[model samples]
Target: MPPPGQDPRWETMGLVHDYLAAEFPLINKTLSLAKVNTYGLIYEWTGTNSSLKPYILAAHQDVVPVNPETVSTWTHPPYSGFFDGESIWGRGASDDKASLTAIMLTLETLIQKDWTPERTIVLAFGFDEEASGIYGAKYLGKALEETYGRDAFAFIVDEGGGFKDVYETIFATPGVAEKGHADIKLEVTSPGGHSSVPPVHTTIGYLASLITEFEKNPYPVELARDTVPYDNLVCMAAHSRDIPRSLKRAIFRSGHSNAALHRFEKDFVLQDKFYSSLVGTTQAVDIISGGVKSNALPESAFAIINHRINTLSFVNETAARDTQTITSLAESLGLTLKAFGEDVIPESFYATSHCSSQSSSTSSSKGHIELSLAFNHELEPAPRTPTSGKESKPWDFLSGTIKATYYSHRAQGIKTETTATDGDNVDFDPRNVDGNTDTKYYWNLTRHIFRYNHKNAAYGSEIATGVHTVNENIPLDHYLEIIRFFTTLNNECR
Candidate 1:
């Protein structure tokens, strides 16, 4: 909505913090709006957390940098927060700010009623999630681990919606696993030569051919990443009366179901659930750069490939193999993978790779392994290196919160744990509903995670698109609905 530097409109981050303090005293700890750099900010709202155990609900404030050309395409001004005939418009409105507002409102409402809980609640509002959450949530999450152990809170909830893109893809849509972005750089080098007296081959030419090979080869397509939570999909496919008989047979393998009927329709769009889960290895080239001048025979060429490794099993191996594959392909054209940067981590030609090294990976992979590598080699990935310290595993504390919340909301039709978010336009709320996908994060941690909020569901597709896009906005009605959802959830949990 605003240029890179300044936007006259909207509240400055400091003002937002101050406003929250003024709005409620029980947000009691006040807000910490900080910037380690000009571009990053991390904010925290500490209210009542259980001394016995803690809980966290996170939302981000910064929206994606906007594209001006596409600004006019929106129904309303992108940053205006304009309330037209129906929806409210503005950047960060839908993607996260709306959720932030809902969390704020829910907390403020509870505080006014003097509501306190058995578990402490930490409202972690991050800035720069759009920038991959490095300085914001990731940093804050690390802070918690440092202070209270890996399982600091019973759970942590962040930016995600409740439902699916289209109704047909899966019986239920859960944001079970987000593809962690593996940002990479592929570089090629060679001795420079004059273009006029060019040697038969130049570095740029070699690199160009390597790039072509990467493009021609994509990670073998796995229908859906297993991280998608196939169990939930199977659950939805089995007894969902909403599905037709022929379609249901293909989706679910019930006793009365015919495998043949589903075989022919295996290409069904809903099969994406199965496909995504089944795929463990995938490769993608994210960026490419090279060459010095048009008249010069460039000495080098390079490209960045973004790969999302399915799970820990193949990340390092796949990336190295792929990088080596690219190297071989390039060398065939006469080129190499020479890495730069003074602090380059000496990756093993024989070690595990971290393609999706985002917070989730850190938590899922490093949270335990890094802490225990030296002591427990079996737990560590291949080429196990010894670490100085010990690994800290996830706690059993989450089980209590899950059980408590489940019983608390059972009467309200909240059968969340095994359920997946399914349906576009569904009302998605994270605080107290099964409508969100945070369940998946715990699946690997706790063996099972479910949704407890049943009221409103929003398609993950719609919410996810708004995530790093221009005109990031959400409807006020949706905001109010979520606020209502949490308020009810809070009361039920009580």
Candidate 2:
């Protein structure tokens, strides 16, 4: 690919495709494999022939469009592919471009080093992943099942994991499961009337009151804390049992006494600001409208409150549906409810059809597991009890990966535990489940779904900044760290 001489967006896709598919062969592949607007382009690289099954390594090539004028805001050119001493800079530097570069650079280096593993390593670059990968990865995944049985992949690596911090230090965390998206829009309407002859409360007034009420205390459903974060944290803290112990103790004791007041306050705030928000239900009012104009006295005001649940259920978790229920309870007094954008609710069209939820450690899954899901796939909340699938099993695969790579850096030979990063008590604060990508696609399949990114490094609060904003930035050092992660992963991929 050209070394960022020109803005890559125009010819960038073609160049990337050529490099991965034709030029270096591995690095430059397909620009749009699916070839459909929804599917986007793709590039694939096959590993050297070997008896072992292949591993699917994925990263999307399509980047979020940048502001044409302010592109210079990038310290290093977004597409320069330049490695500054401080850090490599670019758009998608952290969100996913870093991940993409990692695999690309790893393969380029490995191929040059004349290294070939026992398994066929499949490196895929999707063109349209920035839009949730419906076409790129999803379509490729379908093709894989058709070509090889469902179990063809030993494992697949997507942008689920990234480097983060446990305390003030950098902690490399891998995502095992991401919360699913359940969008709920609570719309409240009241009798529309003129400002001159108001009915005590307008629709906007009523909806605002309902929102105020919901805000008093979010729905209190529990989230299943995926064992992965805890494992990473324990490892990050060097297995210091004291930290988590103190944190957990605080969670329990905060409710009981004033004696532990200070301890509880400090600990609760940290936990709430750090880990608790990741796995939970969250709500926010993004839009609302009721009146048409001034003077004439319009009727009807509506509040559109968006909600996402951290429940085990696939895409569109509890809060999306529960918003209505919450509104219903508050409506009898005179408020009306209506949710807009319900039509845009995500539909799951595919499932891990070949794999079985019943597979045991020793069980072999069917050759192919892909199923079609309807657009309006309203999944029932999974059993309150957690369920595990071989595809989505949170176990040594995750913990082992982290341990093998970064563990050696540690002084102690401590072992780490792995579990799905689900919401055990998500509803406690609805913020965790807001209409966000954290758990959107995860709710649909039983595969491992983890939501993590590098930006959290700067935000001491560990809150997600709803992706794509003017201030979107990640540390250059962290960007390099993620690149190194791919280096470690490829070296250790089993």
Task: Quickly count the clashes in candidate 1.
Answer: 39
Off by over 4 Å in 2: 1-51, 64-85, 164-171, 188-196, 221-238, 241-271, 296-302, 312-404, 407-467, 470-481
RMSD of 2: 14.7
Task: Give the candidate number with the greatest TM-score.
Answer: 1
Model 1 lDDT tens row, 371-452: 0011111111111111112421111222233333323443355433223333311211111111222222222222122233
Instruction: State how far residue 108 of model 1 sits from its true place (Å).
Output: 0.9
TM-score of each: 0.65, 0.63
lDDT tens string, model 2, 125-198? 56656655554555655555555565565555666544433343444444444444433344443344457886
